[model samples]
Target chain A: MKGLLLKDFLMIKGNVRSVLLFLVVFCLIALEGNDFLLFVPALISFMMFMTTFSYDEYNKWDPYAITLAVKRKEIVFAKYLGSFILLFFSLIITFLVALGIGIYNQNFDLQKTFTLLLGCGASILFLQDIVYPLFIKFGVEKGRIGLFVGIFLLSFLLGWILKNVSISIPQDIYSFVVSYLPWILAVFLLILTIGSYEISKKIYTKKEF
Target chain B: MKKILEVKKLKKSYGDFVLGPVDGSFPGGVIVGLIGENGAGKTTFIKSLLKILQAEGEIQFFSNKKEDIGVVLDNSFFPEILTAEDIHKIMKNIYKNWDSSLFFSYLEKFSLPKNKAIKNLSKGMRKKLEIVTALSHHPKFLILDEPTSGLDPVVRKEVLDLFLDFIQDEDHTILLSTHITSDLEHIADYILFLDKGKVVLEETRDVIMDTYGILKCGKDEFSKISKEDVWRYSESRYGYEILVKDRDKIKKKYPNMIVDKITLEDLMVFVVKGRIL
Candidate 1:
């Protein structure tokens, strides 16, 4: 596991643009008057993780990786964990910078902004949990296209539902959903990820090269 | 002797090309050369053994009491950005017996700078890096596909020597596939030749070397030998040159036949695409 992590870091180190983009987004979010930019860093981090994985897949290194003694379970977990770690750190930086910007601007509200940022971050994690399995099962090329398209369509449909429905009953629905959705999605996708790992293991074991 | 690697009735299909239900085995302490022309299922066979493609077969591996096999292929293991050190770390997690010290030592022996990224290295250096990592693990079996293809003779010789070092142990076994038959002629104990997705010849190197003979005969004398015995014959200014599988029979039948030593390449040509007499 340590070896796999070290290797991942080393390979990612070659792509300096990713880190630079992370920083650029972090700074951009810090300066934004609204809390919208906070979500950008997390989204970018997740996408960067996806991109790194895509690069690995394109080169056909997965079979060699499995031969190294690391189980399929660990490979999937490491990727998920790596993305989360990067997201966590990027959020912290964005939060701190946003706080600094709030103090500088003298009009920013820390409490409300932090709340929005947290909600957005959790939603990103939820989306990732669902998308990762697709990537694993179908590979990044077609899976990525399907993922983004699905997300866009789902978001659009949700927007249509929110806009058309005149039910004025629940103001706490956003917080309610945000609070429970990530946990539910995480547990469900964790199970799905495990199943994906088993499939990957079976596929790899049968593969000849 | 323990069986280091075995492949039984392995079959794989790629659209139009089909790699058979081919069965072969390699015992410990022997080097097996998998020789075939381009697109003759050499890579497919190696891939099948490594389980790199989905195939139906039984592949058993001995050594470390596990199916732990080392793979030394072309420059396809590490991506362009990862360094040797990075690869060392990655592989340590993959191989229970991965020895970092051994890996670095092999890298140093090859004069490969550990800090330099893989993409920056020359082709020969990249190949050396792949070999270093593949051999670092204490694997009992190795599947090397085209390890010596497209390299200068000097470097090829060096890599060949490394392969020799790999099988120095009595328990180690290797299936080295290449079109460069001469490189393996000296070390290979057994040779399996594949022509068109089929095993055309499978025998000990000594038997192959002993069996086939290139004979020089006058045009008139060529008529004396049986046409079935002639694998391929060529007409030259001096006379007729021919390849015969059963050289002893021909010599006994035609005592005046000028028989010469045949190389593995000669045998392959005659067996594969050689012009019939």
Candidate 2:
């Protein structure tokens, strides 16, 4: 299991262009002050995760990889675990950078820094929850189209709800929502991850290969 | 003595091509050659064994676990960005008995650069790497599909010798599928020839060689042989070359006719032609 994880990590390392792209994007986000920097880790981690799926598709490696003793569930779980691991590391690195910038700008809000990480992580996890199953079922080629469309619809729905419902929540309540949002998202993602894994496993298990 | 692999009533169809429950079994301790023409479903059958195709069939190994089966497909298993070392790490975790020491030894023997990315290696080198990996696992059954398609004779011989050495254990069996029939003439114990979607012939190499013969005779003498035993018949200016399964019977009946030795390639040609000899 550790060997498989190491292989995935090395695969990510070997693909220089994708890693370089993440680094470039991270450096660019650093110039936007501390607020944007908070999302850097999530963005980079998601980028790495998304690219792995694409790489697998482009190379047609999944059919061969799954043939090994590694179950389809493990493949699916590994992706989720790997993504989160990368996400966590990226979050730590970006938070430190954001802190440095916050100090430089004299707007060092540790609370906001924590909130941003929490919010970004939650949103990305939800996206991961949704995208993982899509990739597993439809594969990377056509599945990606659905991913884009789904994300678009999700963003649109969120925008509409925010625009129409202007409930005047107190600041304390808003802070409460922000603090618990990750937990709520994490719980939802956990359920979705397990559900998605089962569905993917069923699809993969019955798959002819 | 036991069946190592059994594919029963396996059925797969493309728009035009179809392979049937290619009922066949690989018993332990022999090299089986799956011979077929282009698009004759040789690779398809092999892929089905490895479950590469989403086809309907039941494929079971003699052992409860499939880890004992090592598959070396025609193409590179890993992507170009990966080096041999990376594959070793991945395979070590996947196979229960992955011998890293043996794998490295093969790498050294094959002179494959351990650090070079697979994408940078030539086709032969990449294939060699896959074979090295396949062998190092100590799999009891080695399933090779078109492993020696376009290589020079020298490399093909080397690979064949490697396979010969692999089956030294009585428990080891090899299922090699190839279009190059001549390459398998010496090593293959049993032959399974596929044509179109169906199996044309499956028999021991010696039985096929000893039983089948090409009889050269005039058009008049050809009518004397039974059509059931005649596989294929070709004509020329002077006479006809007929491939007969019961060569001795045909010879005894037509003593005057010239009975020549037949090769596996000849049998394949005649069988695929679907003609009476």
Candidate 3:
């Protein structure tokens, strides 16, 4: 598993110039008070993680990797581990940049910034939980198309719900839910990520080279 | 002799193609040549043994640990963007016994640039790199699928020499699948021929070359030969050619007939194209 992680990092290292360029560009844009500051880094990190799958598919590496003295589940776990590490680093870097920009503009609200970063992190995790299993089952190319369609449908459903449904909540109940929202979201994301990992492992173990 | 690999009733099927029910116990310290035409299940058999594909059967390895086996597949490898140096680093972690010095020595001997990505290297160079990577771990068993396909004659000979050197310990074994039968004639101790997923013939090089013969005779002359001795026969404008199992016996019985030694290529052609008795 360590070897697999090293390979993914080395492959990502090949594109270091582009990654740095993107980070600098996004930082400059965020300094202009763009609301997309958190989203940009999160999306960039996810895309970087997806490129590893593309490289693996292009090289047909899985069959050869299977011949190595490693378990099938380890291979799946390694990908998930790589994603978490990438997201962790991205979260830290994005938070620092947001903090610097906020301080420079004289409106550095630590609580607001922390909450926004947490939401961005959770969104990225949710995207991974949904797409990793698709990639495992249908491969990167087909899975990418599937992801686009899934996102479109999900947005359409959300839009329909917002326009058609209205729920009245008491002021006390709304305040309680908002106060505990982060913890609730964290627990939900954890369960979903675990379920996704198990599903991906099952797909991989039964897969023929 | 100790068996390095044993397979019993191993089988895989997809669509219209089915790969085995293959049974064989390959001995250590010998190079076994697997020969067949296109779509003859050579790759499937190799993949099954490696567990790269799901198959139903019993497979036992004397070493028991996958770390002791090395593999060089024809179509799959590291991403083309990675350099040879990267492969060394990655493999060092993957294989517990990977020898970096030996790997670099092979790269130097092959004149492969450690910094160059795989896409920049020529096909032959890429093949040499794969072979060296497989050998660097000092594995007891090597499973090679067309490891010599794109190589020049000189490089092929050099790689063949490496295989010879590897098996000197008498605990190492190699199973090589190739279209180049001539290479097998030079280094292979035994030949396992597959035709349409079935093992048509398996024998030692000496026995195959010395005992199997092609008898050239006219129709009238061929009629006198025993049908039981002939494996297959083909007729041409000039005469009829028959493949016989015991050449010496046929030669002794028909002193006037011409019975010539058979090569692996000739044997494959006869078995695949010749009419059955």
lDDT values, one for every candidate:
0.75, 0.79, 0.92
Instruction: Identify the CAPRI category of the predicted complex in candidate 1.
Output: acceptable
Which candidate's lDDT is highest? Answer: 3
lDDT of 1 by residue, A1-209 (tens): 66666666666666658677766766765666766666776776677677767777876677666555665567667777777777787678667767777888887687776676667667667666667766776778877898889989999999999999876657598678777865765576567656655665454444343
* Candidate 1: TM-score, chain B only: 0.91
**What fraction of the reference interface contacts is present in each model, in order?**
0.54, 0.46, 0.75
Ranking by lDDT: 3, 2, 1
Q: TM-score of every model? A: 0.85, 0.89, 0.97
State interface RMSD in Å for all models.
3.2, 2.4, 0.8
TM-score of chain B of each: 0.91, 0.93, 0.98
Complex DockQ, candidate 1 = 0.47
lDDT of 2 by residue, B145-264 (tens): 888866678888988999898888889999999888887788999999888989878899988878889989887877776677567788789978888777788788888988888887
Candidate 3 lDDT, tens digit per residue, B156-250? Answer: 99999999999898999999999999999999999999999989998999999989999999989988988897899988999989899999999
DockQ of predictions, in order shown: 0.47, 0.47, 0.82
Question: Residue-wise lDDT of candidate 2 within A82-188, one digit each (tens)?
Answer: 88888788778767777777777788888778878778877787777777778877887678799899879989999999999887889998998877776877787
CAPRI quality band, candidate 3: high
lDDT of 3 at B35: 98
**Sliding window of 10 residues with minimal summed lDDT for model 2 chain B:** B72-81
| Pairs in steric clash, model 3 | none
